[model samples]
Target: MRIGIFGTGGMADALGAHWARAGHELLVSGRSAENAAALANRLGAATGTWPEVAAAADVLLLALPAGAVLDVLAASGPLTGKVLVDCTNDPALTGAPVASRIASASPGAHVVKAFNLAPTDIWQLTPPAWEGRPLSVPLCGDDPAALAAVGTLVRDIGATPVAGGGLDRAALLEATAAFVIGLWFAGEDAQAILAPVG
Candidate 1:
């Protein structure tokens, strides 16, 4: 599978490494062409402009910051019929879910919300395993095919993909990220808040 990554940041590097190792074709692009070229070289992938990446990929990973998503997509031309995987989390979360907003911005693109809850460090773990179990990633999207594609990518990094329902529920995931991030900063155990399964 050809994957286009839209950032050269930590998340892009971490996830891009996994996908590249999993034998997926990668085109990495960012605001800085030089950084994108460097990252692409490190990952054994290709570097391109944002428009080139968008045109070359079947799946597009928006690994950019939350605030930049709208502006970046707006400048990237049409996204009709594209599978757009959104990994952004807005700490403020003042508006609609990022995935929904991306859907509105791109119109016909299939937007899937994923990989926001986990920190970039976790993705660096080979297989992303905790104890003896693979990490379970929660995903929300309206399109089944798009969800399946993203799910496969999730599994490619040795994580389990759990459905978090449709795109309408993506805000919940974003809210959870904000709350969990707060707990992490406060040096609290976020797992203590959840009860054991019955």
Candidate 2:
């Protein structure tokens, strides 16, 4: 898919890199030309300003923070019928506020919430722990095609995709993040924690 990402952080870069590796036409956009170009160069894809990014992509990814998404979406103008992949979390998440916050502003696109539970390091260090025993990643979205496209990409990374149901199920995904964090703080092994959630 033609993926355009709106953020310039580590998370965005990691996912962008994967998409680039998968041979997708990836666009990295934001206010920072240098940052965007740097990431784009690393990914060996294209880089541009926000407007250019929005105009030339099939799938748009909001790698921004939860609270930032609504305002960005509003300013970004109508994205109706577009496919949006959100990796945002609620700031009020004392124990994972709610993953539904990923769809703030009630996005018009096929919004999917995946890749939020784990650290961006996972993508850089390893897409999944092992090639065969890939990590189980939970996802929730409304469109079957969008979900399946994402499912294929998730599997391409050697990870298991757990269809957590419709878009509203984002709340449950958030709860899982909280649970994962709790387990980690309580000293549970990382690989063993998210395995059963599938």
Candidate 3:
């Protein structure tokens, strides 16, 4: 699979490394050509302009800031048929999901909301786990093939993919991230809130 990373930040470094190690071809691009090149070098991937990367990738990971995502997408040219995995979160708790916005911006792209729940360090884990259990990632997307593609990427990074309903439900996942991440910032065990149901 050819994966394009649209950011040069920690999220890109963490996840891109896994995909590269998993033998998927990667092309990284961002606002900063130098940073993008550096990240690409570190991951043994290639660097290109945003539009070039957009054109070349089978899957594109939006590891960019939530505020800048739409603008960047608009500049990336056509994204028809691309599996766009949105890993960005709007801390403002905006009513609409970023994935939905991306879908709106790129008419034919398959947008999947995923890999936004955890921190970069967690994703850096060989297989993020708690005790003896592998971490379960919740995925929200309308297209089956898109979800399946993102699911394979999630597993490549050592996480299980949990079906989180369709694109309409993605806002719930974003809200949950805001809430849980807030709890984490308060130095609380966010996972403690989710006791197993009988």
Worst 10 residues of 2 by lDDT: 95-104
Per-residue CA lDDT of model 1 for 65-181, tens digit only, reads 998989989888888878999999998887888888898899989999999988888889998875566889998999999999999999999999999999999999999999999
Instruction: Give the alpha carbon lDDT tens digit for every residue of 1-198 in model 2.
Output: 888888888888877777777788888886567887887888887887666777687778788876666666666656766677777765346543333543555455678888778767776645665444557778899899878877876776667889889988887777667677677768887557435554
How accurate locally is residue 22 in candidate 3, as Cα lDDT from 0 to 100?
A: 94
Off by over 4 Å in 1: none
Query: How many pairs of residues in model 3 come into backbone collision?
Result: 0
Model 3 C-alpha lDDT per residue in residues 144-178, reported as the tens digit of each score:
99999999998998889999999888898898899
Error of 3 at 96 (Å): 2.1
Supply candidate 1's per-residue lDDT for 105: 93
- Candidate 3: TM-score? 0.97
lDDT, candidate 2, residue 62?
83
Q: How accurate is candidate 3 locally (lDDT)?
A: 0.92
